[model samples]
Target: MPFTASANDFRVAPATVTEWKAVYGEVETVNIVPARARISGTVVDVRVTEGQEVRKGAVVASIEDEKLALQLRAAGARVAALNSQMTNAQTELTRAQDLLRTGATAQARVDAAKVQLDVLTSQLTAAVADKAVIEQSAREGDVLSPADGRVLTVPVTAGSVIMAGEPVARVASGRYYLRLSLPERHAAEISEGATVVIGGRSNAEQPRQGRIAKVYPEIQNGRVIADVEVSDIGNYFINERTLVSIPVGRRTILAVPPQAIRTVHGIDYVTLKSLQGTLEVAVVTGERVEIDGKEMIEVLTGLSAQDEVVTR
Candidate 1:
């Protein structure tokens, strides 16, 4: 006959457990901008130093071209001279017309004077137009920033000569992002807007929240690449080629050893070992979680904390 047991016959221990699921994610990228010179000239001044913050369209430096300056001055003088000539031509043309009407001057002389006045007026207009072009070139002498960003490099000195379309400084714009790669199998599970956890060497416990922004179209080296956007990280100034980990999703359920659970009468059940005796408790099972290379079924119900269950 089976031995009889009392409530004190069996010992029980409380187990605090939580359910979790495994997921996969990938790393994303941030881009750095390199500012280039739009016009050619000597560097006049460097206003902002390296690592300094700058605003959009701010003048980072000035370029001086003596030739351009002389051209502008000559254009201005030519315009003034043409304007005086145009005034004198207009007055002479008016007097010639008055003399022709009074029969003091011949019509042919009047016609010639009118033609001369018209030619001088056209020259004056052309000179004024040329002066406007020179003034515009003078404005381009100052090197203005293309966008708001921090200065990364100022390659030219005040006297250094730079060619047109050459790069003057490099700037990194916008918030930094981490670029990472994930296995192709895991990439399919991640979608845009999915939340993830980022892990690094320094802050292991303190995880940063990130979201899936994009996934690459093609697979490379049996892996799919993606970009994750981190929020509220605040200008951490991450450099290129930084490694990071991302969490995709979470799972929660009651876990039990696979052997401890048995299928009977088409229902899942667990044998509970209480001090009084052994009682068979019916339960609902969820997705299996692998712990220490052992399979454990999630316990849905019919089990409480501190309950002793048989494990084979």
Candidate 2:
């Protein structure tokens, strides 16, 4: 019996396609910057956790120095004492000036009183400045993120004592990319600006694409390091593993759409629209491939590029 064919038909042709090799790549950021504590203190509050997204200048954690509070108290006391002394010196200066005007006190005594008032005023200014310094140091305890990114790890916890310049949280800065280490032998083929398919099985129907933004010059451990830039790879994990298909070479082959091929009893068959009529021909199909966002099947044998296969 002749097999009925559908309205749509596919033409088999030898099209040059990229031959891809699958390799594993880990998600990584371009820069890993740490948010450090500007002052030595104990961690008081942590506003962020691992895998949390943060903006630039956002406070990641807060550190509190118990000693800073004590120092501030001492500074306040000194400032208060100097202020009191300055007021008394001003009163004495006024009294000495009045006595000199009445010819009761010597000019030297008035001069000494004026000098005492000036010295006390300067001392009060210096003490106030010292108090401000302590307050500023206490405010520096808040650790802030240097860049916009996701927090990769937090090494400090509440009540943990950390010194100045110690990292409280490490952030993965900027968009995520897939870092791949390919075999050294394929180093010659891999180049910057090349296209790569990302995150799909061995014959994915609709695979996402990525570009090789950078290629490392030196090979490490018999592998060439490369970075692939995918626009929306996400920042869910820092070292998440995934597979990528990179083009290593190119090949020419006769391909037909999957709609043109029908499988029966494990043997793949395709309907051919010949001059006589629609004929069913046994075709040995290879891997199911994705070409230009369309699903296709590789015709290994029993078919030629000139044949017109009917879609069924």
Candidate 3:
């Protein structure tokens, strides 16, 4: 006896079972804002060059202000003078009390001497405070770094005269982040501590991992903004306006070639052919995964590991 030839007679490739899920994401990039100087004067010294990493509070540049230095010196001299006068007054007061105890000075004289000592003491304190203010101003002449970062721009060279509050150098901090602009609809899905995949260029393999550190409260221009800090990205210093791709979420599901599945009567079906026969099996489809521009549909049901499906 010979068996009749049917659709099942044609051998079909076995469907490779795979789990997949819909992945929603957006393109992300690294953004940076340079820091500026708070005060300025003539650039006396440039401590850091371009691309030099600096620690927080490190002196990046120094400004020379002759007038400020002179003021500081004068204030220090005044303080020293006041301190000497205060010491003399204290000695005199001690002597006056001793003389009063020995009945060689009137009590009124001793009281007057005490009042003079107090006045001198107050003057000394005031002078010391004034000197501190002057010294602080002098220290401000040297521009210090606000945070740990690399010098991105040195707008002024040594001996360049700069006005007060003028920027001498621009610095990009060592800390880096991926700034993502997501659609307003997806804003609610993202929050601080969310996992993300960060990579340079969309097609790059082996992306670095990151986590959401901050999420903006309000939407701008129909987009919600967030920042992801790339953990363990190494010493690579990303500059402003560098484009990168970030994967916000991922999952797994059953997938098959889109061509292998067909729809009829508002139902998804795949032609399952086995050695026994060919049968139409209804299946619930899930998210589609695109690999090399070919689409694969996720299978939910009506298929088993032992069955084979033909892509027609």
Q: Candidate 3 — worst ten consecutive residues by lDDT sum? A: 1-10
lDDT of 3 at 284: 93
lDDT by residue (185-224, candidate 3, tens digit) is: 7766667986665554446546666777899998999988
What's the residue-level lDDT of 231 in candidate 3?
A: 67
**1-312: candidate 1 lDDT, tens digit per residue:** 011224433222322333222333322224456666666788888777787888778887877778888988898898888878778878888898999899999888778878888898788788888888877766776777777777878888788898777777777667656555677767656677776666543654576677777788889998777777877654454453434545544454446667778898899988888678888889888767554465656676777655667765
Error of 2 at 58 (Å): 3.2
TM per candidate comes to 0.68, 0.84, 0.55
Alpha-carbon lDDT of model 3 = 0.67
The TM-score measured for candidate 2 stands at 0.84
Clashes of 3: 3
- Candidate ranking under TM-score, highest first, comes to 2, 1, 3
Clashes of 2: 0
Model 1, C-alpha of 176: deviation from truth (Å): 3.3
What count of clashes does model 1 give? 7
Off by over 4 Å in 1: 1-31, 200-205, 238-243, 248-273, 276-312
| Model 3 residue 234 CA deviation in Å | 5.4
In candidate 2, which residue ranges exceed 4 Å CA deviation? 1-13, 200-206, 259-264, 270-281, 290-295, 304-312
What C-alpha root-mean-square deviation, in Å, does candidate 2 show against the real structure?
4.5
